[model samples]
Target chain A: MKALVHEEKTGTKGLSYREIAELEPNAGEVRVKLKTAGLNHRDIYTLQRHKPTDPPLIIGSDGAGVIDAVGDGVSDIQVGDEVLINPGLGWKEKSDAPPQGFEILGLPFHGTFAEHVVIPAENVVQKPQYLTWEEAGVLSLAALTAYRALFTRGQVQSGMKVLIPGIGSGVATFLLQFAKASGATVYVTSRSEEKCRKAVELGADKAIDSNGDWHEALGGEKMDLVIESVGAATFNKSLDQLRLGGTMVTFGASAGDVVQLNIRNFFYGQFNLLGSTMGSTEEHREMVQFIEKHQIRPIMDHMYPLSQFEQAFERMEKAAQLGKIGFHIR
Target chain B: MKALVHEEKTGTKGLSYREIAELEPNAGEVRVKLKTAGLNHRDIYTLQRHKPTDPPLIIGSDGAGVIDAVGDGVSDIQVGDEVLINPGLGWKEKSDAPPQGFEILGLPFHGTFAEHVVIPAENVVQKPQYLTWEEAGVLSLAALTAYRALFTRGQVQSGMKVLIPGIGSGVATFLLQFAKASGATVYVTSRSEEKCRKAVELGADKAIDSNGDWHEALGGEKMDLVIESVGAATFNKSLDQLRLGGTMVTFGASAGDVVQLNIRNFFYGQFNLLGSTMGSTEEHREMVQFIEKHQIRPIMDHMYPLSQFEQAFERMEKAAQLGKIGFHIR
Candidate 1:
């Protein structure tokens, strides 16, 4: 199998393309011949040596492909069936299952940044007919994330005001579309003027510049929900702009994780500060349903063949693209 | 008219035992001759000037008294009927109607720290016959607080483990009795060993200290509910000790208000951090039932005459008292 593997932590090509031995699937496992794999900022973080030190680490988390093989007692799928590998196999289909520590694809384990990756049968969801290979591959992470944070945890509702802090980030883009689909009033901010305009074109009710003072500009009326990926620097400001009893859903910490808040504001006005991680498997299924129903599409600035992996990493490191920048590995 | 006025930002003696102009009942108002007044920490906050200062601020919010006079067209009660003032009064009530915001006593409003308080007729809940003046007075804030935070917001259940950060704080005592009545495994903590032992006698399963590695002492078993009045320094420790999908209610920040948290922990684990100000008037009625049904008696530490208020406050300031430190004005 010709796969991208990080040898020594240097640059993006720290992952030198090489032919590696493909392993046989274990019992209850299925091997996926990847058609397309999505790249995320997390992959870039690992490339920059932000992740645990391990040579030959496989990087991509989200992907879609055809099933190549099914292990013993796997009555699940036959060869040639197209599917979406749920990026995180450890996400329990059973709601009552206990937590499986460190299971996200690409983070602590071998990932989809390869020609083939083996996973348990439960991690595979049938990709909807409406989506392309590239779309299905990328949808697992971003769409499901937005689904869980906004719907299940955030309890977002129709006709409510929702604010997303930045434009063109994968999660932010998905939030914009998903919120609109749910009948919420979506507002966004962007460091790039063009991205702001693009967000509005993509269903955001309003898009402001990066430095735009959202709290004051919105006057005394505050948002019902705030999707905060950027942290620290914007945390207090985010809390300030939420309506009394409104919730702030924090998923990422592009800024710093630690933040301080005035406790009185929470009690007197009734505010909730909710922290969210990735979607549970059930939430991911919901994501697929929502995306297929609303015809929501992820924004991919560029798509390349697996061979151009180095170039893709460079663009991602510089953030020179909008939304998820990825590669197909067939 | 006589009122215990705080002339300057000083302890106990700040209560200037002086005469002031009488305030007549305005429209929709009634004058009550107070029999018993409850003490909330907010009054202390006002005295110490931790809260914003405007001198001559009337103290006390929770009051049980006789309706001495009803202003024009006020027919809710005839002269001399016993009632408990609904301190947080947010809505108007019919003459034969129910009380509205009954739980928010001793906040910014002109409270009942004196012999007479003029408020709208709607601000009163008819006193149940079984309660004594002291029981009726103290039940409004602390008792209702525990009910709302534990059962209402925290949704505690029988056999569930509940952790209250303090042993004898006004709310903590009520929480201890309430959780025990609800069949919960109640745990309390205090800096004082004596206080911890006393709390165990008051129905706490265990009383941990706020000192040296108390979290490890909790055996890593997650709590179902944690009632937090102490804030900042203890928030993370509480969060860490909570199980997945556990609820932490923050109603007061006795230690400090500002706190930091990792948002992901809250969202992914389905952790809930609810901020409760004061429960509704219905909650006050519920607390009244709870107290009478449970025959719960507040832990009255000592009684000080109005003139000895400084001594009472000194006890509170030193955290020497296990229960409410009160002053009698009558």
Candidate 2:
């Protein structure tokens, strides 16, 4: 079996599609032949020297596949079962991870960007036969993040106002639909007028440009929850746009790194600044159930073959797409 | 009547004792003959021109007194009932406030440093008759703050590892006793050996010097709740000492303003940066109950005649006293 091996950690440019010796399942690990993989901006950070790891990085955090083999004492999963990989599943191993919290996949170790990814048995969750590999592969990170933001951290309620800074993100699109389905009025942002219009067609109550004029975008309305991933640029505005005592969950700071801390702003309004990370495994499992129960499908932007990983990454880098960028492994 | 009044819109130095027309209680007001006023560091900040209020400044926030009169529709207390003057009382007549957040006492309104003060009927709560007036004056801001920090915000449990950054604050002194009462192991920080010994006698399990070391103060241990108020000085270290999923509640920022955000510190450790204002009416009510039930008293450090308001402020500004500096009125 061969994989997308990286001699260096530089993201797209580091990959060398060459045949390597097949890896066998280690103790408590499962060897899965990946059918589909999802790409995220965090992968880019790892590649650009932000995340330091040993060479030959098999860097992918999100993937879905069939179990080719299971390590000794594996009790839950069987060979040939379809599954979605929990990227960061260490703490679930009942090992070093503290009780109730675990590590995320695709972060420090070899990821799922290849044909076969060896992961801990705890990291694999069974996927339904009815769902396509493409859907299963992209579901874990984006969907769980949105679920946590809307329900877990934010406490978004029916008839409440929620603002998503952009609708084109894999997570943002998930959040908009999730909020709307949960009886919330959704506000989306798009840099392009066309994309803004498209978001409205997709059930957004209002769509505004990603540009700084949010006051006019929503007619000077204050929202109950603001999902802020575009960190520095939209942060101050998010603070201003939220109703008093509202929550702003900052899970990602994509636009820029620095975030401002204004004591008077936070204290006077009684704001809750919750820094949400990826999410819990229990939350991820619940998210899958919710998506399935609601018949919700993540918005698909484009799909590519394994060899065209560079093309997919380039598109993401250019920010030209609408939803998730997926790769269908052949 | 004579009182200290600061124009809330301006930070000025001319806050002085002056005679003013006695105010009749409004429909939902209570008039009190203030016996003592607690001096807090926030008063200095208001004096430094923080609130943008005009000033012929009369500054004092925390107070204790006897009720003199009640307006129409007021039924709670009678003349001469001992009570605390909650300057930043939330819940009535003020909608711009966080439903029940801290009221900006003394800055925008005439304060307790005067002979008499008037406010909403709800702001006056019964003070423990046994407590000294100076002690009662300082009780709410620090004691209620400690209550909220531990039980309300931090939800501190029995047998938990707690790290407190400073033992000098009135809140810190209350926390030492409160944590011990809760059966928790409390470690406190101090630059003065005398203060440390006093904290130990009061109830601190261990007191460590902030002699340019983190692990030493921690006893090479991690904390479950970090009491942060020193702002940039201790903010970074507070986060480091917490266990995974631990919390740091910042109710005060005495060292300075401005806290830097280190993303990796947040993601890797699973820390929570909780911003707590003073508290709510419910919190205040609960704290009063706790105090009455436990017989906890504010450590009154110094007291002067009401005419020596400037002397009290000077002591607080110079950080020359521990616990509380208060004014005694006739």
Q: Residues A1-330, candidate 2, lDDT per residue (tens digit)?
A: 556666654556677666766778988999889999887776777677533356566667889999999999898889999999877664432111136535556655667777888888888899966578898887788887778767877888999999989677888888988998889999988788987887898899999988858898689899888887777767778778888767777677777666657654565565666666666677777787887887788777888887777788888787777778888877
Candidate 1 stretches greater than 4 Å from native: A7-14, A45-55, A93-98, B8-14, B21-27, B48-55, B72-76, B91-109, B263-270
Residues A1-330, candidate 1: write the lDDT tens digits: 988777666557577777877867899989999999998877766667633356567778888999999999889688888999787656665242227573678756678888998888878888898888888888777777777778877788999999898676788889988899999998887778888888888888888876777766666567989988877767777777777667888777766667776776787656776666677777787788888898877887788888888788778666566687768785
Candidate 1 lDDT over B1-330, as tens digits, reads 666777655655557666766677887888888877767777777677623355475677677888888888887677888987777566232111123343344444566877788887777778878777776665576776677788767888998999988676778888888999999998778888999999988888888887746567776667988988888867777777777767788888878888877764555566777777666667767777777787888777776665565676677777687876565657
What docking tier does model 2 reach?
A: acceptable
Question: What DockQ does predicted model 2 obtain?
Answer: 0.36
Best by TM-score: 1
Task: Indicate the docking level reached by candidate 1.
Answer: acceptable
User: Looking at model 1 chain B, which ten-residue stretch has the lowest summed lDDT?
Assistant: B91-100
Shift of residue B216 alpha carbon in model 1, Å: 2.1
Can you give the DockQ of every candidate in the order shown?
0.45, 0.36
